[model samples]
Target: MGYVLGLGGPYHHDAAACLVGDGRVLAFAEEERFSRIKHHRDSRSAAQSAAWCLRQSGIGWADIDDVAVAWNPYWPNYCDRIGDAELIAELLGPDARAAGAPRRLTVIGHHLAHAASAFYPAGVTEAAVLVVDGSGDGVSTSIHHGSPVGLRTVRELPYTQSLGWMYQNATTHVGLGDWTNAGKLMGLAAYGQPRIELPFLHLTDDGYHLDLTRYGLPPFLGADATSRYTDFSYYRDLKLAYAKAFTDAGVPAQPPGGHHPDRMAVDLATSVQAALQQAMLALATNALTLTGTATLCVAGGVALNCTSNGILARTPAIADLFVQPAASDAGCALGAALECARRRGDFTVPGPRQAHTLLGPEYSHAAIETALAAAGARYSTPDDIAAAAAHRIAAGQVVGWFQGRAEAGPRALGARSILADPRSTTLRDHVNRDVKRREMWRPLAPSMLDLTSWTTTPHGPAEAMIVAHHATDTAHEQIPGVVHVDGTLRPQRVDPQIQPTYARLLREIQAETGHAVVLNTSFNGPGEPIVATPADALASGARLGLDALAIGDYLVDLTASNTTR
Candidate 1:
């Protein structure tokens, strides 16, 4: 069996690395986790992440037979310089190459890698794949047909008519945040009615369209924005343009960095959200008609919009839906690696379905102990760590729960999560205010042992927190912390088979309280990446004022004195 290493986005944000052996993914990680920078927007490659992956897999640079990069430099359309291959070469250094490093380097198309990331791992015979994101290689969106053999692009749309751009523009206008804060805008949308009409954004026969000239918006959404990520002057100019557009559209622009959105801002957010959902549905319908398949797998940055995913899930056109958990650019690393494996004849058709995203580096008990001792933390070796954690949460304490291997994607799937009592009505605000130190408007998700009892919608792939579900009346009364203002919740359905330790903790929580749900959010404060190491967990717990921390078999009480007891 051959090993393939994939790298994504040194030029773009969310730089990441993934390693695939044969057809299975052995390791994956985002550069932000190690760099402690949100999105790793410093234009640095995933060298640290790739090194971590190689170390985790117990392999050296020579063991990798192929290196796949999630970019096509030959794409003549885009002018932006892409250097993922060179970055990997720099990462390997001169000594490794002198020692006779592996073999070949392959560059895959951006959207093709995205399609492979979704379709191959979906384990379906045939399906229609949709990739909607900010511009990639000058293409904003594309639809593909996937089978055991491979993927075929049926349709492609230019970046000029981008839904991601429209949403991001509205996000800035509404004072929610920038491109990274689209999810915040989505959460803010539920608070208001979609009464405003955006003349520039509309639907076409096959896809969506955005008239950038109409509002004097940015020339291209992601193309220009991504290239100028750190350019505050550019963002200021763009913000002014959007502000003027909002004024022209009859809605007053909300000032940036507001805790709560005003009525106009809320309405604008709602209008953009409604338009996005409609456009996504239209595109999905077109994809289904083109491919003649009931199964649909989606990737790319826009696939991370749980609100839109929920609307599509409820539609009758899609019978089965699978979304890449790490649908953002970070996922492109995994996609590129998978594509490399497939071309090498190592990855076969009808590939294995992805059960869980617990594919990152795992720490041993001794490592955890070493970190704890070095920190001189006050802790205890609990007989049952899960039970102890459950008791702490049942008592309305915000506990930091870190166990097993870290999750690969953005969502904290029990492995590196901050747990709280979902029943408390004020707990959400408390956590948002005191712990995360972010806006109170954003909603937290629940890790449920069984989601069927909570959601009214038909179940598909709630295993990952990629889609939102309409909460039942029972959920509203029992787990209000997880439910948003619109009565919808993005949930991670914890399966015992895949996440046995987390499931056991949920069971313990159920025994302590009547509900089998817990308020689960990523284990990090504002503008920080998810905790990756034992030291990361300890530092975050102390910094965030967590009541307790369950790391491996040990439980550290941050509320007590720092002295070891």
Candidate 2:
């Protein structure tokens, strides 16, 4: 029942840490925020984030009762547990260990942590849980039934049949960066037709079949085979294979940095996307039948696919769905802590539902002012910061809105976002080109006060912007800037109670622009993590030439010095 620290990685991407006390998540953060790296792929860097969590929670190292690692060194095969213990000891530091800290240390399977993450935070009495991701502990996908008793495994698929690797390979084949660039692939899929047939994926009554050999890719896990993620030769083989496949298909591969992608790339993206949705639907159907539950909760990296989540939500098979906001490997840290607490009889049935992800660091007014002064920026304390920022957006200005704690996941909610008027298509293009410096085809998302007016169907809980919905005609006419070319949007519906200030801003925008939607993106430029501190916010705002920055209760204006708008 005491404080338990959960460490996610020293071996995986998106390293993170979480602290739990009295069966509740006290603090959770990804190492990327502190390291300033996109995914913080180096798991050793997670120590800094873990230290920050303890500091943020005002809990000393001596106060921590247990430490839980999200990786199992003795799963299916044995790894060097002694090396891992040494790493953990180093992470804890000699000074802390000398103070009688960390009474117990526990390690759990990776997919089990993923399941705990999705099932516990979902706050459902009983549901079917699905964990789908790249290879984790030799398993890529699993199905479980969650009840008051806990989660029970139903089925598991080996890493060799991974859907995640299939998508990642296809992403690279189409000339999108790599596995990290799957989101770009998903976005590009909207611009093409699904005419290309991928024979590697076959949907069945149970789960689906994925054959990597069809694409000239080798098995992800085997006695002698190594992970393709770290194998450069695998990529070389992939290039040659894709070259042959493209030549046989009579299409050319798209190169990076272009206004328009090649026809073949888009078609491939579309086909893969279609196949992924179908396969996910089939798998969900099987989970529902196996667990005999009407509600479903999903986690792991693949759960971040908002397009597939939208399709699942739209289908009649899934009555209710809960997709973890921080579904990536980073979220496994939180799940580990929760699982540890539950096993120790600290957490009760139907644990607290994570209504929001504003779990990272928060700055005070004095800190914001100090940072603002250090930046030598022109600023003022507005009577109504939301009203001021909304008026600026109404004047067609892109503004940085930094409020409360930073978000825990990749998507930027109201906490740390760049807000703009969503009425003009020109504004969207301008933000993409000048501010974001990303592909023109990649669409911006929206945070709305009333989501029902924008989307055509009920798209489950979108408080996290992790699910996409077909846009209604009203949305296209009113907020084209946030709408994609395919008439779909990944929208975040603001909850007044949880985000009162942001909801107030949306209301102000409604008064001025006659719509409750505003274009909301992460408060950082290209190749940077979201701003974690006021200094980060000010520096990014200045570098990106933002019109205004609403940090805490102060409004910093930069219109006099910048004329880009």
Candidate 3:
């Protein structure tokens, strides 16, 4: 067995790991899931995920043949945090590395890894690749072409002009913090019009260029600043960076809560989203022009821009599009592993395609029972767990649904999710205010038994929540709780073949309410990472304002006063 362990993060956020053997991924996990920290910003967190991956493979570090790191310190420039042989040694510990003598070590370019994660797992023969994020390996965006034969670069852009950072600064200006709240900004964009423009940004032959002076920033970051990261924590007038970019465009700045009718925050979000989508569209089109590939794959933080992804999927230049579900930095490890496997001639042409992303850990019924028993809560061994969960949702009672394996990405695709009735318009606010205690503007996502059942899109049978979809009028009426203000929704298409449990639950809901949709959010409340273990699930279900938790064959009703009903 050619055991290849791929690692990401520990240097920054979204740390993750994937272990590959015999040309297939054995396991993959993100640090934040185990650590219970949202985007756990440490290498140790990712190292923990690596250890978990190794354990799932039933092997130790000493048995591994190679270590493939997702970041290269030498690309465009050098940084001390980049993971190399010594860094890997440090992570695995001296003892483990010592036993795995002369273990092959490999470095993958950040964007290349992103491309690999998208193209390889997607099972695409040849596709134009687009990788975008907040600066990795000194580049914010790169274009490539991927085939089972190999992956080839078309062009790479410098980090000086980053769409991701502009979006981040915009996020901060609107009261949401950067990195984590960027998606909130995406949701906010739907409420207003795009009445502004950035004067310093324009498309170039390669990609786009920006002048920081437009936002009162220098042409470049500080000399000591690493090209891969430009001071997100302590920048002077950080919000003003993107705020002025809009205020200078003759639009007013938004109020604190971003709610007022004539306010500019929503408009700024709208314009930022528009500019980003247009730029990404250009990049994807150009990738096709340069590579002459009809199929396309996108990854990286910007690839997480679901609106842009939806637009890109509809572009005539692209015959097929596949965006990795974990398009963010957490997916880089999977890409690195795929890249190493290619080098070893194990990732053959037309490589293995992912049937699903249930790559994280799963808990047994014994563990679930133990957790519920320890919590001193009311629970039951329901003969029909799915039917009971469906009844709760249909009765307008919120539920914490924990079943099978935990999902890998930020989405709660059935497995570790809070389920609610999607037919009520007030449900969104209830979940936001009473349950999640999050910003009121935050919208809820949904899982449909079939994409065609609700959404009207030419694009997919997608299981990952990486792309966006527009709702049909029928959907608007039936699933009002899940639809956003702009009539668009981020939906996960639960496959019956791979996700039988989740699909059956949806069917049960349909049997009760005539609608096969449920508002699905992560199992945890605001500011908490998605719950991983049954103990975590039990703890979150008790305090998250959920009425019941449907885990394994057991149904735990928190609202009831009894121990087992």
Candidate 4:
């Protein structure tokens, strides 16, 4: 079995790395979690992430058989300059280059890698694959039929026609960074109903197309680059167009002290989200029509929309659905490695590996103690960490729960998460405003311990918190904090065997509160990547307004009003 290292995100958000050996993922992690810079863009974007993967996997650079990066310098689809090659070349180590031996440094197509990321590990032999993002080698979306043998592209939509850009525009208007705020808009959209549309966004028979004249930006994807740092601006004039439209519509900018998108902002967010959903559905239906595949696999940045994913999951056209947990650009590295492996044309298909996303570094009990000691934190090593955490949440105290290996994807899952009482809807406001420092319109998610008793129609393995589901009245009454304004929820429901710590905590909380749910979110402050280390968790707890922290065996009281007991 040959070992291949996969790297991604030199260009955009969620810079990440993965080690795939024999077509199975050994280790993976995002650079942002390690660097503490959200969506970090740097020459060493994949270097730290790659080193972490090697450390966790107990392997060295000498053992690597190949390196696959998900950027093709010369894809005919996009007219951008061929700098992706230079970027990859700059990241290679000198020792590797000094060797006279031949090495594989393969450049894989952007969208093909996106397709492979979903197809190879999906545990399915055949499926209709869709890749949608802000831009992929110059295109916004691609549809393909994926099988064990290979993937064949059926249709393509250029970057000018981008649902992703539209989402980013709305997200930026609400103060979330353009590249990193689509989720905020998706969360906000639930609070509103679309009563209008702007001329900038439109859906056609082919797909969604953004009219530059209406968007008020140049037609090119990154045309905002000016004379100095060459850093591209995200929809500068396009944002002005939104601001003008909102002003004309009588929608005021969000007031001081973070709050929900004022009434009219919510309306526009709703419109953008609805339009994107409709356009995506149209494309997915066409994918089904073209490929005649019962299963659909979604990849790329836009696929992270759990609301659209929920709607797609319930579609009558597709019988099965799978959203690559690391559906963003980060997973493209994994996809690139998988595609490179298949290009060798010599390996047999392996068992399903799609659902295993806990590929990052895990901390031992000793390490957590070290971090506590370093911070001069006062704490007690509880025999039952999960119970202690459950008790705190049950008592209406928000608990920062950090355990085991960090999840490779965006969702926190149970490993590195913030836990709270789901019974109180008002807690959503507390966490949203004080902890996350985001608008209250964003709903918290329920991480259910047991799925059997829950009142939800989970369309897929929601353990990774990807698909949105309509909540039953039982969910609404018992765990209102998790239920969104639209009576829907995107839950992280895990198997007891898979996450015993979280499951035990839920059971303990259930014993206390009579419900098997907790309001769970990524263990980080707003605009930050999920916490990666014990120190990261410790520092963020006090700043993010958490009451306490359950780090491994230690229970740290983080109520700053009191001592750090």
lDDT of 4 by residue, 1-565 (tens): 6778777765655667888887777888888887788876544557678777777777777777777778754444443223344454454444434432125467777888888888788778788999999876666799999876688999987765667876786677655555676788888787787985566666777566666564355565333222111322444555676666555555565643325456777787788789888888888888888898888989999999999998898888878888899999899878877776777653345337565577889888788878888887878888899899888999999999988778878888888999899889788789888888877778888898655444457445576778888888888777888889898888887677777888899999989999988999989886688888899988999888789999887899887554555
Off by over 4 Å in 2: 78-84, 89-104, 214-222, 225-251, 562-565
Superposed Cα deviation of residue 173, candidate 3 (Å):
1.0
Off by over 4 Å in 1: 77-87, 90-104, 217-241
> Which model is ahead, 2 or 3, in terms of lDDT?
2
Q: How accurate is candidate 3 locally (lDDT)?
A: 0.78
TM-scores of the candidates in the order shown: 0.93, 0.94, 0.92, 0.90
Clashes (candidate 1): 0
| Model 3 residue 147 distance off true place after TM-score fit, in angstroms | 2.1
| Model 3 C-alpha lDDT per residue in residues 1-565, reported as the tens digit of each score | 8888777654567888888897798898998988778888644446678778877878877777777777775554553234356755655545555655335557787878888898888787888888988877777889888876789987887676778888887776766665777888888888788877667678765557777675776555555345324444324443456677666776665454544424566777888888888788888878888888898888888888778888886677788888898888888889988888888887776775676778899888788778877888788777889998999899989999888877888888888899899999787788888888877777888888776767778246357777778888888888888888887788887778888888989999999999788898878877789999988988888887688899888888888766553
- Candidate 4 lDDT for residue 476: 78
lDDT of 2 by residue, 1-565 (tens): 4888877754547889899998899899988898888887644546778888899988788888777777765556654232444655655554555565564467767888888889999888999999898767767899999998888899999766678877876777677776777888888999899988676567899879865475577555563345443454654665566555544555566676534678878888888888888888888999999999889999988889989999888878788889889998888888888888888888876987889998899998889878877788888788999999999999999999999988998999999999999999999999998988888898899999777889987446788989989999989998999999988899999989999999999999999989989999989887789999999998898889889999999988876674222
lDDT of 1 by residue, 1-565 (tens): 6899887764558888899998789999988888888998865467788888888888988788887877755553542233444544654444545555543457777888888889888988899999998766657799999977788899998755567776788887777677888888888889899988787776877767766465555554554644553343544555566567777877877778858778888888888899899999999999999999999999988899999999888888799998999898888889889888988888886888888899887789999999999889999998999999999999999999999989988899999999999998698899999999988888999999888789997365787888999999999988899999999999998989888878989999999998889999999988789998999999999999999999999999999874676
Cα lDDT computed for each candidate against the true fold: 0.83, 0.82, 0.78, 0.77
**Every model's Cα RMSD, please?**
3.2, 2.8, 3.0, 3.7
Judged by lDDT relative to the true structure, which candidate is superior, 1 or 4? 1
Candidate 3 ranges beyond 4 A from true positions: 42-45, 74-86, 93-95, 98-104, 204-207, 214-244, 250-262, 458-461, 562-565
Give the clashing residue pairs of candidate 4, or none.
none
Tell how far residue 239 is off in model 4, in angstroms.
Answer: 5.6
lDDT of 1 at 560: 88
